[model samples]
Target chain A: MVKFFHHALKFRKDVCIGCSHCMNECPTQAIRIHGGKAELTDNRCIDCGKCYMVCPVGAIIVEADDLSRIFDYTHRVALIPNILLGQFPEGVSISQICSVLMEAGFTHIFEVEHGTRVLEDAMTKMMEEKELPRPLISTFCPAIVRLIQVRFPMFTDNLMLLKAPLDIAAMYYRRKLEEEGISPEDTGVFYITPCAAKIAAIKSPVGEESSPITGVINMDFIYNKIYTKVKQGLSGKGSCCLPAMQPLQPEEMVWSLTEGEAARMPGRTLAIDEVSNVIEFLEKMENEEISDIDFLELRACDQSCAGGILTSGNRFFTVERLRKRAEEAARGNDSMIYDTAGDSIRDHFDYLNEHLKVTQIKPRAMDKLDEDMEQAMLKMRKVQEIMKDLPYVDCGICGSPTCNSLAEDIVQGKAHVNQCIYVQKRWEQEGKLQPKESMEILKEIWGEDKF
Target chain B: MAERMQFEYNVDGGNFTRAGFASSEIKKILKKLNVDIGIVKRTVVATYEGEVNIVAHAYSGTIYVDIDTERIRINLKDEGPGIPDIDQAMEEGYSTASSQVREMGFGAGMGLPNMKKNADEMHITSEVDKGTEVEIVMFLNNKE
Candidate 1:
């Protein structure tokens, strides 16, 4: 058995309506509808949020850090995602945003966008002599990365080895705090994030572990406070260009947009907008048809971080204005973004890639999958034999997706074979397909069942 | 026609809400059978894509799923006016989806190509006057 460091699918049983929504949406089939409840199979799920996205009644929620958990620590740092900057209303300066975090019980606050500067420098150096895959995929979307592990394992190498904005920011903050003589044991770093995916990533990171950050504060909860402070101009004056904590290079600032990753790297690149669109593009890449593209910038949300579900601004106008701001800011700067102090700083901490130890156990052989392969085969054969005697109209008025899906459901004990619209049509056509016993079964399973 | 496993689905062409019901159910059946995850996914994608295309584009159609120990197959047959050119239809950036379909966040022009890419073998035959038929086969253990 492989030792997985993450928790299994966490279901809020109260919210779950037993609609089989998660079971239907899950790509790995890790979930099943049993006894009118969604049951998850241990060790099968890849932690992709497909089920999380598709639940109708908000039944499923991923395991996330409650910021209240970090209250036990003496000192805490809030590493805020840059997207949170736009979540406030007009006149909110970066200073006011930082101040609200300080006001909301954080000892210190750092912009994660600044962390992108350090990461860009490190990544550029790493890619200098590399023969990386054409159309190298962005590792930024944790949900997308998990999707790759389950559905597109062949494309894993296309991901950049560099850590994401939160991790890199956490690293920069921890180092700065440690240099000031703060002990790692006493300091806790929490990511103020825009989505549930980041919380999942922090708790069970894909590539690395012992994350620089300790937990997350829901951006939804803190948005109003930060906005109110920024609106009231409560914070002291400070240049957005030069913060007192540290200076970020122009290249790092550009990473706020969609293709920002490829813009910083030297190569052919493609930036795909929207999570749903990336799914189709990845399929093309898998087929070896989109070989012309060299690097891919895949943003889960449309308009990059600007369109995160937690952001308060209108995405189109904000993205346009932010782009203009970034271009103007970058015009005069030509300095290298990394620090020489980072060398001694990198050595003091113990860094480990948490996912290095992750391994998947092989599934049992097909014959051994169920002791009743013969029984299943009998059920299938019966389904087919019944299909030959029935009408073929597949209309899902029967509640399944198609006639075939219904027949399979019937075999699997989810539905009765007589639900096919054609079967009813055949009974009407021949005046005999619906004998009483099967009608009773259909009525028993599907209330108000009319065949 | 080649020997097909022969299953049918009644697509609610008028209801956008019931669109992927068939695909979801097929996914479940494949899972219970201990089908290869890759094959199960490919079948589901092709099945849903075809089913959606029929419901949204063609007036309506029946989606068929055929599976054996050796391979899994999907055939989506619609009784609507057929494609003008099958080759042009196979292009990655081509789409015939409606505005209503696009609002649902689909119609990327990648559906047909994605289905083809995922399946190891595919055969499509259609006539302008009659209905169109698409057959896709993904072998259980074969490398593409």
Candidate 2:
């Protein structure tokens, strides 16, 4: 039985050209070319959105809730990350963005990073505990958390089982609304996400039973809507529904950038970004080659959330804009720009802290060939035996990501050993397989139209 | 009875950059075979320390890995100036490593002790002038 992992990335077979770009670039080798399309292994995909970035035909779509979903509740709140503010040009003020969100049918707006302030204190407390594992890994990036679960299962214990800023913020905001006499069903909290992994996390959270967030709108979609409104000089200034935007603290403003959490932690910490870099570092860490670190801030994207696949701005520019905003907040220059939103989250710190923890995240190891030890060992030998004839070129012509993966697939009964072009050539020369039969195999793997 | 899988990886002496290669390959194999994660962790730690010992102290070495349903057994054989005082070498802080090797973080004299701590069964054999051989076995069923 195959376990189903909810992925926000959806592949449209009609638009995929089977060019194999996504298969080649996937960090986990989760994609395989089949029937002239890219097929995703549900358990293997971490929903990092790397394939979405590399697709030439825009076939890979990040699933998002329809904007109309916000109208379902009486009190609609837009929970947005700080990186969303960095998407706009310097000319567009934060006030203008809030007004546009209000114009887009949201009754309230809240920054996700506000939850980090609450998390920072809890993290420091966690670091002070002598009994926990060394080098506690942050659970900020959903993609990195899922990556660790599927690829490096041993490190799952090292993950700090705390809610991410988005979750904390959502919980805080929902509680605030509840205190204001709004029923839970009447309040809808929609997160404007910068990546598919965030959507997946919201839909099928790893440790927690379910997310407090009611829906997710992709950052790119909201960015386009706000940018278009801003450009047309249609941002409703002084609208009656304008939210009293709270000025985020400097540290909170830059919490999603690289080294954001690591710099705030108590002890020696290292921040590594980009999926491939994280994988390399983790492999060494798993081998016990690296040790004695206090905390690890691992982000799937290069510049952290600024480099999210759904982000519209240039990653470097987004980082620069966010850093500038942080500096301005540090200087107290933004205090005059917006009014106080409401009671500070610190006022409810104790209540929020009580709900801050997530249950232990179970490791769903994708590398295991079988559940039974004996069967897995037998499959291992069969994969090795099949690998003997492979060219080891990792051409992806066999539809699997690498020659080794093809062998594993063959042993698992998902693929045939003859799918290898090298094996087909050898067999043809040996007069064992006819050329027409080999061509038929290619058609079966690649599709009839491909020929 | 399950069929056993055998693998051998060569480790070049003094190659710090490639010290974890054999252990990493073996780790991948154990993971694919659905071995208990605790067993995998201990096995890799022991293999890594042993591999690094060969790199920091030996001329050359080969790691022979044998895996069955019950347990994983690894033997590391290397040609080098072997341990004259095996008891002292197994001490936590005792060091025969050169100053250069210490600077590279390879030799803290914790190699043999770390292997012994992680492995369920460990054995050492050495000749004063010829070589050293270390064998470690970790059971798949019972975990520490």
Candidate 3:
């Protein structure tokens, strides 16, 4: 059986050292070291970029659309998240960044958070429907959505069936352009993404049939392009060509930070950041050890999107900067320029709301040993039987994260029982396996060079 | 096939931090065995409530789990102050836990009731000043 799962984080075999760092650090146990290279299990990987963070040799790469793809459309719109503004230092003004994007050939720049205004009202309406399940999990972070689908399949219904802000923003822009006499083919909406999951979500969305956004540009790539222009003093001169900017409200400005959505949600809501923290909390929630939570805002990154793997700035400093900006917006002391053209998102609220909902998300659980119950039971018994001979110590020398995982692999015929160093040592002591034979197995796993 | 798998886990009483360990292990095993998710949720909830009861009231306890193709049975036996009246103890609001345990959010009077609600079959037996044994059985194939 073939299972197709779109993953944005790519593992390059030539660059991997097979050091086991990525294999050990993966939260989903999606990576394995074999033949001196790291292999990613497609269905198991959530594209959370955890392995990308730990790879010392830069073997993992985040695939994004090339910048030149924007030029294909006559109306090029850059849909940027609020975190992009946080990536800049205080000395770099918002207008400077917009001017750089405009100089780089973007016809219009829109803040992705502007769509949150439409979402706030829709979410309030959703909370009013008591028939929905309690603790409605936010679908804000794509990685968290995928995590729930694969790891906690029981909670798939708990996910909010609503489009993310990026989707809303992209849809609104595309429709707005269509109304203005520009064809959909001529209007290209590009999202500046902070993580690989967002890129994957756009490429092959979970609950949605298709994405409105035309392409994706990594935030780091755009940050470098803008910063270099600012340092060269070219951004200030290009401010004359800056389009009328839409000033984001204080709440919308901080909508991607931790507790951003939870603060706005009605009832007893809780926001959890970091993937491991979310996993631990969900485990207890699944066990019914915790209850009465009306809403849950779960993010895959630690500081939310500020800790995105593609972000270039320090997560803490970026959070602090965004918070300060939000305070300024709240106080009406924000010096950023606003567009008087009255092309506000509020004007297109009805149109955006009509397309706000996503379809029901189906669970794609990765835990079962087999599709059939009897076969799974047989596989489970085989794993348990193999586990009796192997030490429980989670030494990753076997290329699997834990001994239990190695046992599972052995049952599935992906690995051999002799791949375990402890089992090999025991067999050698018993004279059942020769040293030369064990060394050959190590060479097969770690490559001929590691010996 | 009528094959069965049995496993044992020790539960340390008065340690609320380690209360749900056994339930988590059982949940993992059931998930790997391709049990229905609805069945998994009910079994885990029933097992968790029983585990917490052992930690909240007993001195120490042991959980014995038996899994077959059709059902999952868990037996939680604890050595501690046994209940004098099983009828009163089964009530939702009746708890003999100390104020400290209540403050720590453990000794909720709902433990037994919750276990009964999630499990397909539940039985409790106790001897005064001796110990308590709780057995919970959940059907894997037929879920309500």
TM-score of chain B of each: 0.87, 0.97, 0.95
Lowest lDDT 10-residue stretch of candidate 1 chain A = A352-361
Would you give me the overall lDDT of model 3? 0.90
Task: Give the runs in model 2 whose Cα sits over 4 Å from its true position.
Answer: A2-4, A239-246, A340-342
Model 1: residues with Cα > 4 Å off, grouped in runs? A1-11, A16-63, A125-132, A228-245, A254-256, A331-451, B1-144
What alpha-carbon RMSD in Å does predicted model 1 have with respect to the real structure?
10.4
Interface RMSD of 3: 1.2
Clashing pairs in 3: none
Better of 1 and 2 by TM-score: 2
Candidate-wise lDDT, in order: 0.63, 0.91, 0.90
Docking class of 1: incorrect
Of 1 and 2, which scores higher on DockQ? Answer: 2
Please write out the lDDT profile of model 2 over residues A161-183, one tens digit for every residue.
99999999999999998998999
TM-score on alpha carbons, each prediction: 0.60, 0.98, 0.97
Better of 1 and 3 by lDDT: 3
The stretch of ten residues in a row with the least summed lDDT in candidate 3 chain A is: A236-245
* Native-interface RMSD of candidate 2: 0.9
Q: Candidate 2 residues B1-144, lDDT tens each? A: 567889999999989998999999999998998898878999999999999999998999999999888889999999999999899999998888899999987788888999999999999999977999999999877744
